[model samples]
Target: MPVTDVTTDPEQLTMTLTAEFEASVDRLWQVFSDPRQLERFWGPPTWPATFTSFDARPGGHAEYHMTGPKGERSSGRWEFLSIEAPRRFEVIDSFMGDDGAPLEGFPSMRMTFEFEADGSRARLRNTTYFDSAEALEQVVAMGAVEGSTTAMNQLDRVLTGLREYAQGKGTRVEELSDTLVRITRLIDGPRDLVWQAHNDPELMRQWMLGPDGWTMTACEPSQTVGDSYRYAWAPLEGTEGESFGFEGEVLVVDPPRRVVTTERMAGTDGPSTINDSVFEEEDGATLVILHIEYPDRETRDMILATGMAEGMEASYARLETVLAE
Candidate 1:
């Protein structure tokens, strides 16, 4: 419930709303990029939005409908004009038909969102332009001002919950040596549950995807020493036959305590790495320590350069949701 400033200027033919969040810019960007996350805070308290389709790139289109408490529905669409990744985007927002087509004679608003980074916090400025002063007043009369303010107010709660989960899994990476990196976290779950979530393919798919738009096509984990596990990922929007493979052999398997494995990134032709994972519990919270050893320093550095920390943190945040479920 911070400052949610909403201003409507008929002279400028625009309605602008500015708000700040306690999360990082990247985290705030995810809420806009990921449709699943966007649905959580895109509507007022009495009316929750459900996105039927969403694509967060330039030239993409989004269709969603918000249902009222009395079963009334309001459908909308967004035609993205430009995108600057985690910083800003412009879209044409309008009322839509059930077939996902723009309705004729309807007043459309051009919305621009700018996300500014302020250290760990972020500031979001949104401006919605109308064709004329009358056009703006027409929508404002339909409750656009109140609905937007309410939706923006819900963002803090959604972002706070995500941050709390990420904090619980205190995931951090330490470069122990040239060829080795240590990743440690205190996961808010029991040891047995954590171990099962890691070894179970169905559970692994729920959280293993990083920030990419890829989906885990396959997860075959053999929970025994000398057995092999194969995990495959392909872009959710990619063409057929394009995929990345990761295969590993279980060297040691001690359930709820330790596991040793060797992993090779098949598509990248990257050097294989040996991973040793240990789990310890205190006060019903499991502490997970993972050591990844590469063949050489260059190999380890190369992987780290690909923003592995951010990707792993995103994955772990999803893992937190899984554990809570």
Candidate 2:
């Protein structure tokens, strides 16, 4: 709606819009718990005023009435297709005639929402599915596709505002999968600066937040194939330290070309849920690749949809600034 580029393939139509909220994901979740908040943004300006009878539960109803631009009112019922509490919600939306009349032709859509987070970053992805290609084509023709995207973009803005409003909130990410997120930066400085920034705790403290305001407490090399160490975090003063351990066999540590740590960040050690970081030279700069491999499939999908990328990007900016200072 705001002239954003739309990229489509045979499988999906991808429209990405970003907003940086100072509030955490946990705070954002509360804002969506109410139906009133939802309808305020879900309606189009041309659609006449509306109200919703929402049962925000599994197998419940989310019914509403809409006044068209021409003053024609229409009614519809949406049944909750699936739900995973505060993390995910899926619904089957069906349109009907003005009264309790028989159904007309409108694609039945399965809409889903997924939540993910990094230290201070959070991502939420909404995906909807149509039964078939003809169904999709029909909706596109009726302008439903574009209209829905507009609604989702509005929803994004609402969530972002909620997040920024509650800055006192601490970071608590519900990652569906292992590590669930990655951290990487496109550094313009020389190789030494990039490498040192990653390895130095002070530089990391400028960006990566551990648990509560905790920074990296300790990191040591037990280096070799199948060797690793533990890092501790103390977010608040007078709190006991929390430690997470990693033991990884070196896959590659060829200096500037790349460095790989089989280190797992979300689950028990071993190759189970490993994180790999790679650095490559690009015009005297470095293109860093940060990847997290999780053991679960569902978690993987949820994590990818969450706003991890944007969070990582922001931290990278901080890292560069810290190095320059």
Candidate 3:
């Protein structure tokens, strides 16, 4: 019945998550490090938060304030533990009452964020360590699972935005629920250039989103259908993201022509329906089509509403530049 980590140690209730973005580690860090960038997606869309003093440095303090239904308010603070400059961080978090007083019975916890990269992707991990078993249980009971879910939801938007921004431009957009989002763009470059950027870590750093302070752990093609590759990304963004191990299965690989693979993240197994990346030739350029799908109506509509279409369009523009270079 756990939320984040749906698989092993469900009873443990401890969580870790990792995800690869279509942008670079530095771009992702900018979003996480800058408070202004989070203003649009820092909390639930319906019930967002207004943060204060998000100083992200060693020994710096951070705080968030929120007011849910019926005038309910929640505030918290964290004491900066250590910083590795855009890569890793440790901090303690605890809920506080409106009067700036820590909740009497709640347990304080320490959390860490770590990031790594793989080819055109980045792996990130966010791990939380509680002082004791009872402490962990108490926080879980208090709804850290769903709370983190909302946080990650906002996180997804931010990371996705940074990806678009890094590519130099982005637009707020969505696709029709029934209409498959077949995104195609022409990049005026050699086929090998596009393929290399997609397959090489050094080249990937120029155009993909990854964990903050990320490093490439592994990169290789899948040998057979259903054959999987593993890459360890720590300080998971959430339990589901962590389970995917920042790795996925290669369903189909045709080299520079086309590559089909499954993406893993903190989720419930068997990879979501998201699939497809194809490259074709057009007039003096390479036409790339990226088609990603969601399983159901509700999720598709939700994703569409998030304005990812515009973001993708912008990202593709940047990809063109990377490929051209």
Candidate 4:
């Protein structure tokens, strides 16, 4: 992770975060200056930020909202106070309501972001000054530390090109928290084709099989929000394992880009997980990121212990072959 330290001081009424990156100071500055790039890692994986409006100059302000898995949104705005190219910038950050006004009863904070060169690397120091200790404590109690850490750690991937960062990495899984896991893989195909492969039954049957001995017996994919999908697999005649399946309801579908669903074991009363899958295309290839939020820590552990990552990797490898064909 890029984030190194996070500290809060009651006496000073401030919180500070320090992170180091392998990129140069100029590169680090560009990421913050560009709203598109900034939104990519400004929020945690579960709630990704979308910048509705961004003006980077001093005296300018930016409006953005982070959307949660269940389609809930939390809006925020930043008023740029000062800007020093490739070095530092300052802003006043405030919570906003749906009417585009700063929300009442919410404390606004002054934030300063400083970038410095560190001999072929860069260091970022972000300090937020609050009006009172109560305000500082409030944000901390709201999981600010963990949220900021996870948000900053994502900068590493944003800083690198998609292909350079994900290609050849195969299917990688990261346990973000007790109940959240992230799975990522690079598909050697366009985003549209990759999306089609997931939604088309004929295409899915070609590669969605977890292991060589298993065959997809049924695939009913959801095409719209509120629709339910079911997939079942059974071992080949000579194979050993019994039949199993999964069912899920589509919650959100932004074709070729993102899809959110609630997934559970087909016939069981097991807890369901919210799966948010995002696809981004770069250089004729697609990067697939799946963020799964389990119902509990035990559920997360049990699912991961079933060699889920390895199974997904096998399926993804097969998808690459299918795409080539």
Q: What TM-score do all the candidates reach, one by one?
A: 0.51, 0.42, 0.46, 0.95
lDDT of 3: 0.57
Ranking by lDDT: 4, 1, 3, 2
Runs off by more than 4 Å, candidate 2: 1-23, 160-325
* lDDT score, candidate 2, position 139: 64
lDDT of 1 by residue, 12-74 (tens): 999999998898888888889888668766976545677989877789999898765334578
Which residue pairs come into collision in candidate 1? none
Q: Which candidate number has the best lDDT? A: 4
TM-score of 3: 0.46
lDDT of each structure?
A: 0.79, 0.54, 0.57, 0.91
Model with the higher lDDT, candidate 1 or 4: 4
Superposition-based RMSD of candidate 2 using all C-alpha atoms, in angstroms? 19.4
> lDDT per residue, candidate 2, 6-35, as tens digits?
333336633223233334666555555566
Query: Candidate 4's residue-wise lDDT over 84-142, tens digit each?
Result: 99899999999999999999988999999999988988999999999998899889998
Two-way lDDT contest, 3 vs 4, winner: 4
- Which one wins by TM-score: 3 or 4? 4
lDDT per residue (tens digit) for residues 1-325 in model 3: 1123411124554555444565566766676677655543454322345568887778888888654422346777877888885677788887888778887887777887776666765555777776666777776677665566545544543555333322322332334235334455556666677776676766654444343333334445353557765443333344233212346776655567556566554334744544466554433455555655656776657666755565445545666777666
| Candidate number with the higher lDDT (1 or 3) | 1
RMSD of each: 20.4, 19.4, 19.6, 1.6
Ranked by TM-score, the better of candidates 2 and 3 is 3
